[model samples]
Target: MHLDACTIYRYSSYFIRVFTHIYWKSAEPCLILQKNPTRPIALDLQDIHKSYGSLEVLKGVSLTAYDGDVISILGSSGSGKSTLLRCINLLENPNHGRILIGNEELMLKPAKSGELQAADVKQLESLRARVGFVFQNFNLWPHKTILQNIIEGPTQVLKIKKRPSDRCRKIARSRPTSKKKDAYPANLSGGQRQRVAIARALAMQPQVLLFDEPTSALDPELVNEVLAVMRELAEEGRTMLIVTHEMRFAREVSSKVVFLHQGVVEEIGTPEQVFDNPTSERVKDFMASHRPT
Candidate 1:
């Protein structure tokens, strides 16, 4: 059977839209509206621990981020900085811990393997949507246009209508990658792609943002573009947990700095305390090594 180009295009578009609608609808029960909590804590992790086989990655890590706080997680390689970040959203479930977002606690049940898993999958899904994660490597969908990528979560997961979703896409794009809405990810520069990724996360209107070394994969020259966006977010008082090696940026932008050593928090305090007058010998040595000549 011979089909015209228009006919094939129409069929493909219809199927894509229908599939998206149906898939999201199946998860609709898990999508609950968030209520305003009196508590100001945006995120709280208590006594979190993680291990891979015999190697423990995180050891009894606890941190709290009040609303609008920018907390920078710093450590050398294998200090579990990224692992601790991942555990907050359960990208990597911890062996033991408690996590609270706002006033709502993430219910967890122990598994046979002694790992903790989400007790209520629906609730977990609902809470996870409120946390936005930005990766070191830009995780954009190669086939989707930038606009499509930004609007997808709102339109599909949140079931937002076209008009409001369009507004969100515009707001998200306003700060980052405004010129490349029609371009695909492959067409943009590495910095542009990371900016687009940030825009996509912003479109969700998340309560908190987690950046796992967002600029680590970029070239030295391109790093500033992404950092500039993050700096603007900090200035706007966005609650963020950033795992980064950019010591100067952390010192300048973070409300608090946490230095992790050997899977434990070696030191945590204001940027001044951690960077200038750290009491921990390990942290002092680490700071000295990172200090600019």
Candidate 2:
């Protein structure tokens, strides 16, 4: 019996899902859900610092996002906005910091090179699965159809079964790409592709979503399409940390606006305070220059 690649992949995925489900189910009692009853913190970064060789990118940056908070991180170029977002999921590991998702701290151990590394690979993987990240560039597989791209994470990394994965795919499609489910990524427009990226992240059903300048790569006209989807997500009360240059959108949607200056938090306040009545001289200057007319 000669099995084709697709057939083999399907069977293998099924077995992996079944086995993982059973294993995790048996281990459920050992898992702890650490959450504060009064004020639940969705994501926390404490004194995060990251450097490249001699150049420091992030300098003791700290941020906290409560449940349902839409935090928009604003800054001038080279202020480590994207670096900070990437550090949340350890895509670029911070040299020193504490990161917690839902009060569960990510375990890290110092390496010989003086960099922090995940102490337990399994724990890191588990925590990473809970945080979804959307990039500036729409990172989609050119060969895969929209449906396949959306379901890939849940079915593979999450070990979700076919039925549940399909459900997730449906939800994702409904949000962003319903009309183009069967189309390959190459066939879609830039806006459509970015929406697909968002849908792909949504299909993972992450507890917290990170947007690293998601609209930066889109054309001026296409930028709003991506922003509109993001606004809907914000309205749905999803906990999101957005690193964006869209000042108007940030002013309109953010529960909290953070201004990063020279790798440190220059200011943090409500959108009204940050945009309309900023206290810091640097923040005031930034707002004055970048504020949409």
Candidate 3:
């Protein structure tokens, strides 16, 4: 069929437009769109609440952060962002909520003897070992070398003791996390210090790591190095929950972006969907007022 030149050009342009749209939209949903996930639920927070002196912080927040998932809880300061992270690890006690880590349910309320129930304590300890938390300020012990910092949790908190076997020494010396021993917090750059912090967390062999503004304390030029390390962690399939001010990093590295406002979860979705088409007004206001600055 011989068509006029103008008609042929219009049809070709229309087809090209449709093809491009399909191609771009196919990759839209971030990493959560995988067909068959090995574990469906990793951390499920159900109807969680928090308060101080009758002032409510978290008002029935419910959400899930999955295994091998890089999730971001993004919000303005004092919006209970830090509180939520602390609640997850029981660093901050919640008033009312059911926190489930894998199959185990945590006792949010304190017990009579100032101790968790044996089974609950066991599960809490296990989850604590499995979940690692990283601070925004590089919390490396100034007195300890990188090697000591890395192994401290395993040896002390987790009660993993080691004998001086040749194999054990080899493991201690050559362990990937311990290789940073030469660098001290005072001598190392911001990025290196943060990496040491991450290594310290990783040395505990946690299934997931929580990042509390991994790059917030770095110089603008140094931010990328910390982000690169995080990207590497993501590629290695370590589950991570990041609370960051880095909108671009959140967009780039997270499988899910959660917007928190007034101690409540306002929106949760993939980066593109959340950033480009947020369903909530608070999210829209946030996305507009503060971009990457």
Candidate 4:
């Protein structure tokens, strides 16, 4: 018996849905009801396009992230990988596109120059608060201690009062903590800083986490510590969108992979399809070039 690609995808998707329903129902009956048992989309980007003057960065890119999905975006530099991630959280206003978070459409207005702008500032902020972004440079405040940095977003944006001991428990408990929880960024190693950055994002209790080359700045020795934390998050079924050069991590962790080349989506599918049976020549070459010698 033979099955076409579409048929195979459909079957696989159905199996996943069934498995998820059973697992969640058994693990947390209350959450399954609150999250809508059938299907709940966490994030949606429709026909996203961004241009810098005459140079188009992302062209007609669309992505949908279902609850508990980890979609990894891969490409060489200048391939618009990071730009797509930025557009999702409105850090870069897409020239033309629509965004939705959990079935709620974000309001947008057309600018005189024909670019789309958020119609309401407050609405945009509220929408952004739901999506947590982790940048390549662990953008922690230099003067703030690790604990201070972690709680800052919750205090300001989420209006969460600090309950020092409880706060520590809410964020990742297993990650390495400083002997003095108040050590500044300068005092922490690269891995520790990035882990703190992840904890900061988690403190917001976001619907989704967006990671942009999260480990690129760290020394080779420190990358694994950060990756371990990410792996733990993935296991606990966090909805994530990671733009990374860590192909091995992507292959092992992602539910879906999107390959962008020169501002267009070159290939997208499950890890097996994208990595093992890529249909695009550009993706084939890109993977080949990245292979370790």
Candidate 5:
């Protein structure tokens, strides 16, 4: 797929500055944040609510995730963090709300039969398909090789042909810095397995990538590898949203850090703004008490 050349070039230049800054004081980890009111919003969620039986997980919530935003949603377990993500993807429908992705209308609270058009579903599904998801557990197929796992989603779901030489293609695209050429999931380390899972997500040619605790399942030592890969993706300027507990990674990599409390967006702002001077006690308490494990 062809990307915007100018945008891609800027993305590369930004990374160059990042590495150059590491070597000298010439460049200092520049983060050019934009709160441009004119930029089109990428995602819009309004009056979102989810309930399971007697339990109400998400109260009415509204937020906008804008273009070129790399956001991290941090909250304790049972805070409706994952469920909110599910609602975004339509994996779990919101009780009452409208989710607009670009120009398409996604979620529906079930209007009268003739009230909602069937074409809305198609438009929304197409939109969802463009967004890739990385699960907490590396959900790679045990039967397929690493290369096979990477290309299978594009082949099966997107109806693209899987090349016989896809193993080489995967390596070329991933540019694996390590030497595990033809390894399977069982033979690969936790980090490598997660990398394969990530490669699979990228092979689908997604516009936005959503990571749900991508490194939570890995051991402490292996966590850095997965985080490093994510950092590289951010450098590539891929629009991404992540739900994670890694505060250091959040501070280092994300443009916007959102503190979700009780399913509501308590605070959302730049990492330094939120980290250095949090306005909400809920967020300050949450940050003060929880250290990376």
Candidate 6:
């Protein structure tokens, strides 16, 4: 019952690590969702390719999103859904491709192994700011309180002042704020953490928001809470790219649905076209397997 300071510290450290593991998984994945492009094109990916050694993950994958476009990239595991999203946000550079945001294209230089990279760090940072990304596991910092996490990007990266973020206020209104605004991630539930993650992305005021399996990490009961927030955003006409297995959500929310097979765009069209009548054998087979009971 009476533990030494060292023993208490060790237990605390172990609990933090274990809790973080349970709540936040690895952070990289691909999902391209577009909102109303303030410009002609919000986010464009041209013939993107990514390979790990000889195994090519993304092969000639091209995506184009315009104003008010909610495109869902759907596919089975290993179909390169996540890889595609990673490339767009530059989390993982594509072996070869061109990424354009608005009227400006990303400047890149050839890196080793035929890959491409941002010509300069400043350019990459600038581009990332315009594109918001929400990971499956809410990547909120365990040490920082909810408010601190939400405002970090705006103040640090975008050089925004300490003025309150709209998103933070929105989230705060959802629940009674008995805890300090600085309440750590450990104090929040899965759905709350994911909401904070969304707020963090929205605070940047991204032109296009990318969600990589946003609801996959939540408990079945918690999934709807996160999805509701996303739905509200979609209703507000935010451009979103979601890579998910939530077929119903995709069909209901997205204007266009893209099916990727073996790293290539297999089928793409309006949800009705892709879901109701899939042309490709690969898509037909995939849908058949995933059809709800």
Instruction: Provide the TM-score for each candidate, comma-separated.
Output: 0.82, 0.83, 0.79, 0.82, 0.80, 0.82
Predicted structure 6, TM vs. truth:
0.82
Local error of candidate 2 at residue 120 (angstroms): 1.0
Residue 39 lDDT in candidate 4: 58
Q: Which ten residues in a row have the lowest lDDT in candidate 1?
A: 24-33
Going through the candidates in the order shown, the clash numbers are 0, 0, 0, 0, 0, 12
Candidate 3 least-lDDT 10 residues: 13-22
Prediction RMSDs, each to the true structure: 11.6, 10.5, 15.1, 11.6, 5.8, 10.8
Task: Summing lDDT over every window of 10 consecutive residues in candidate 4, give the lowest-scoring window.
Answer: 24-33
Question: Tens-digit lDDT track for model 4 on 1-293?
Answer: 44322222233322122111112112211111122346589998999999999999989998888888888899989999999989876788789989998888889988887678889988888888889899899998998876677667666776644355454544324433425356788987887788778877776668999999999999998786687677657767888899989887787778888999999889998877888889999989988877522
- Measured with C-alpha atoms, the lDDT of residue 59 in candidate 1 is 90
Candidate 2 similarity to native, TM-score: 0.83
**Residues 1-293, model 5: lDDT tens digits:** 53332222223332222111122222233363465557667777888888776677888777676677788888888888888887787777667777777656664546453122233666666776677788888888888776567656656666654353434444334443224434578888777787777777776666778898988999988887677777767766667789999987787778788888887888888888777788999888888887433
Model with the higher lDDT, candidate 1 or 5: 1
- Report the Cα lDDT for candidate 3: 0.70
lDDT for each of the candidates?
Answer: 0.77, 0.77, 0.70, 0.75, 0.69, 0.75
lDDT of 1 by residue, 162-268 (tens): 45434534444543334555679888778878877887777666899999999999998888768777776776768899999998888877888899999999999
| Candidate 3 C-alpha lDDT tens digits along 55-130 | 8899989987677778889998988888888888787777777888766677654546442233366667878877
Error of 5 at 265 (Å): 1.3
Which regions of candidate 3 are displaced past 4 Å?
1-38, 110-122, 163-183
Clashing pairs in 4: none
